[model samples]
Target: MDRSAEFGRWKAQSLSKADLSRKGSVDEDAVEVVELLNSREEFFTTSSCAGRILLLDGSTEGSGVQKQHCCWLLVTHKPCARDDVMAALKGATSEAVLKFEPFILHVQCRTLQDAQTLHSVAIDSGFRNSGITVGKRGKTMLAVRSTHGLEVPLTHKGKLMVTEEYIEFLLTIANQKMEENKRRIGRFYNYLQHALKRETISNSHSKIKERNNPLCTHKNRRSQGKAQGPSTTEDNGRELEDGDGLEISAALFLGDD
Candidate 1:
C-alpha cells in the first residue's frame, strides 16, 4: 500500500467531516488557528473546540461525578457575563457547577514525525496534556490540550452556596482563563508556522545540493549512460538495436523506436 496516498485520502475524508459540523467556534482566534493548521500539507484538523464556560447541574456518585444526569443551564465559548450567569443560576433545581474548559484540538497527521513535532509544539505552548495517539486505521494523531480548567460548585440542592460577590469573582477568573487559552492558541500557531517554514527551507536546500553535486541530477545520469555505453533492448525472440525505444529497468532509451 502507498502510505502517502493513503494519508492524502484520510486527510480529505477528515476535512469533509470537519465541514459537516454546523457549529463553529465562538472564539475567532481559535478558528483562525484551525484554518492555519488545515492549510498545511502535513496536518488536518479532525475535531476542535475553542473552549467554553458551562453551568451544569450534577451530583457526585461513588467515585466519579454522575454527569450523565447533568443538565446545562448555560454555555458559551466566550467569557460569560455576570448577569447571564446569575440568570441561569436562579432556576437551578439541583447542585450547579460552573466550569471553564480550555481549548482542545485533535489533529490527524500524515506521519509519526509530523505528529511528534506537533505534540512538542503544543507542550511548549503550555498545553501540558498534549499527546500523540494512534488512530483506528493506524494513523498518528495529536491531541492538543491544556491543564487550565475550573470546576466549582455554585449551588447545592437549588440553594445558592455563595453570594453574588463570589459568583462574580469566579466569573473574573473564568474570563482570565479564556484569555490564557487564546494566548496559547496563538503561540501554537506561531510555532507551527516557524516549523513549516524551516521544513520548506531544508527541502529547498537539499534540492539545490542534489543539483550541484552532479550525482543525482539529469546531467549525472547522462554522463553515467555515456560511460556505460549505449543501452540494449530485446524483443520477442529478436535482438533489437541499442537505440530502440524501450525501457530497460530504470534506464531510458531516449530516441524513437
Candidate 2:
C-alpha cells in the first residue's frame, strides 16, 4: 500500500474506539492505548480525527476552547500523550500551532544587584538582557522594572500596577534568562581557569630556564669608549669620551618644559 493509505489504516486501528464525551469513563488500560495513538506521527492530522469524535465534540477544533488552555480534551476520553496536544490539534492540518508556543522567562528583582543578577540570568538562559526602563511614575524614585519586551506599569509605591497575568509573564521571561546566565558563567569560569593554569605553567618553565642560564644576568651594561684623541669638556667641565677612550667634543641643547 502507499504511505498515505498505510498511515490512514494505522490511524484507523488506533483511534477506532475513541470516545468523544468529555465526561466519559475511560478504561484505565485505554489511557495508555490512547496516549500511544496520540504520540504516533499519523495522530496529528486531519485524517486522524476524520471519524473520531473530539472530547468537547464541537463542530470545529477551537470553537469552545479557551485561549492558552491546557489539559483540555482533544479526542474524547483519549489520553493526551504528546507534550503539546492542544497546540497540535489547533494546527494539525496547517502546522502553525506548533510555532505559537512563545519563549518565556521569570525574573525577580528589587535592587540594582537583583536587577543585574536577573540580567545575568537572562543571558544564561540564552536571551539578551536588552534593558530596563521606568514602567510607571511614583511619588519616590522607586519604579517598576520592565525587561525582555514586557512592560509592567508601577503604582505610586513603585510596585507593579498591572494585572497578575502580565506580572507572571514578565517573571517567567526573567527566570529563563537567569538560567541561561548561570550556564554561560560556568563555561566562562572553566575557560578562565584553564587559561590561567596554562599561563602559570609556561611562566614557571621560563623562570626555571632563566635561572639555569648563567648569561641571563639582570645588571645593565655600561658603554666603553675607544682609543682616540684628547677628551673634550662641556660648559659644566664634564669630559666627553669616544668609543676608544678618546676625548670628544659635544654640545648640549635644552628646551623649556
Candidate 3:
C-alpha cells in the first residue's frame, strides 16, 4: 500500500484499540502534548507518562524489587507529600520502594525524518536521552526521556529502614525532580507548537496547492516560487509539505529554557 493509505490504516487501528494502561487515560501532565501530537498527520503519541512519585509493595529478593510484580501502594503524578509516602509505607508487607520517575513518551512518526525532527526537539527541551528507532517493518518511533529518576528502598521485610528525617529528605528531592519534569514538559510543548505545528500545517492541502502552483502570487513584496520551499517532505510515492518548514528544520533543532 501507499504511505498515506498505510499510515491512515495503521493510525486507525492503533487509535481504535483500548487503553491498557493502569490509569486508562493520559496522565494530566502529558495531556496537552498528547493532544497536540494526535492533531498532526505526522505524529501520534503511542504511550506517555507525565512522571510520577510512587510507593510500591513487593518481594525483597536479592535486595531488589521488580516493578512488574509489585503492588502500587501510592502513586502521584504531582509532587508528592511526606505524609502520603509515610502512610503508604505502613501497608508494605515485604519490600517497599519509593520512586520518582521522570516524564517519558513514545511517539510514532509517519517517517524517519519526523522521528528525527521530534528527537531534536526532545533533546533541546532537556530530554537529552531522547532517540529514534526504525522498526524492521519500517515503523519510525521516537522516545522522549531523561536520566533524572530516583529509586530508594524504604522497607525490607515490612520494616521501615530509614528514619523519618531521611524520608523527609527524599521527599524534597523527589518533589524537586517532579517540578523539573513539569518544566521540561512545558518546554517541549512550546517547542512543538513552534516547530511541529508548522510542519503539520504544511502537510495539509496547502502542500498540493504549493506543488501545483509554486510561483503564482506576489506577497511580502516579491515572492512566488518561494512558496515551493515551504514544506518538509515526509513520505515517498506517498504524501505530505515545504520551504519555511524546511528552513525551520534546517535552522533549528531549537526551543525553550
Candidate 4:
C-alpha cells in the first residue's frame, strides 16, 4: 500500500484502544520510546538528565521522572533575526534551539522538567510562549495541563506525553507565523515600490526644473534686450540738451554702448 494508506492504517491500529495497558509493569516499548524522545541533543541529552533530575528532586522526591516528548510553540512579538535566535539558543544550557530559520525555531526535550526549562529559556530570550499540548498512544504516568481548551489526546499514561503534542503545536504556530511574515514582507515591498515611485517622480520634477530654469532665464534676457535697446539709444540722443553734464554723459554713454 502507499505510504499514506500505510500511515492511515497504522494510525487506525494505534487508536484501537485509547490506552494500551502493559501486562503489569512499564512496557519495554514505552521505555524505548521515552529514551528515543529524550536522546536528541535538542531535548534533554543524557548529560542534562542529571541536572534536570536534581531540579525535579528539589521540587519533590516523589515528583517522579515522567518522560515527555513535547514541542514548544513560541512567537516573537517583533521580527527576530535568525542569528539572534541561534545565539540565544547557543547561550542557553537547558534547551537547545534545534532549527533557526528566519524567525522560527524547533526544539525537543525528554521530560516536562526539561520542557519547562527550555520554555523558560525561550521566554528569557524574548520569545512569547504561545501554547503547548501533549499526546500519547499508550499508558504512562505523564500528566498534561489541558485546561486551555485545546483538544488533547489522553492515554492510559497519566497525561498524554506532551512533548510530541507540543512539537506538533509549535509547527502549526510556526507555519502560521511564517504566513504572517510573508504577508508583512509583501506589504513592505509594496511600500518600497510606492516610495521609489515617489522619489522618481520628485527627481523627474527636479530635472525638469533644472532643465527649464536656464531656458526661462535666457528668454527673460532676450526679452529685456529687445525692450530696452532702442529706447536707451533714443534717450541718449535727446540727453544733450543739459550742458557740461551732457558732455560727460555723452562720452560715457557712447563708450558704454
TM-score of 3: 0.78
For all predictions, the C-alpha RMSD in Å is 18.1, 30.9, 8.8, 34.4
lDDT of each: 0.74, 0.31, 0.78, 0.31
The model with the greatest lDDT is 3
What lDDT tens digits, residue by residue, belong to model 2 across residues 106-148?
A: 2222233223323332232233332333334211111111122
Q: Model 4 over residues 1-257: C-alpha lDDT tens digits?
A: 75345434543453344443223222222233234334333231111100000001011123448733333323232334434433333233232333322222233333343344333332322234222234363111122111111122222222223354464554455445544434432332243233334334544555565576755453454333233222221234444554212111010011100
Query: What's the true lDDT of residue 157 in model 1?
Result: 91
**Residue 24 in candidate 1, Cα distance off native in Å:** 4.8
lDDT of 1: 0.74
Most accurate candidate by TM-score: 3
List the pairs of residues colliding in candidate 1.
Answer: none
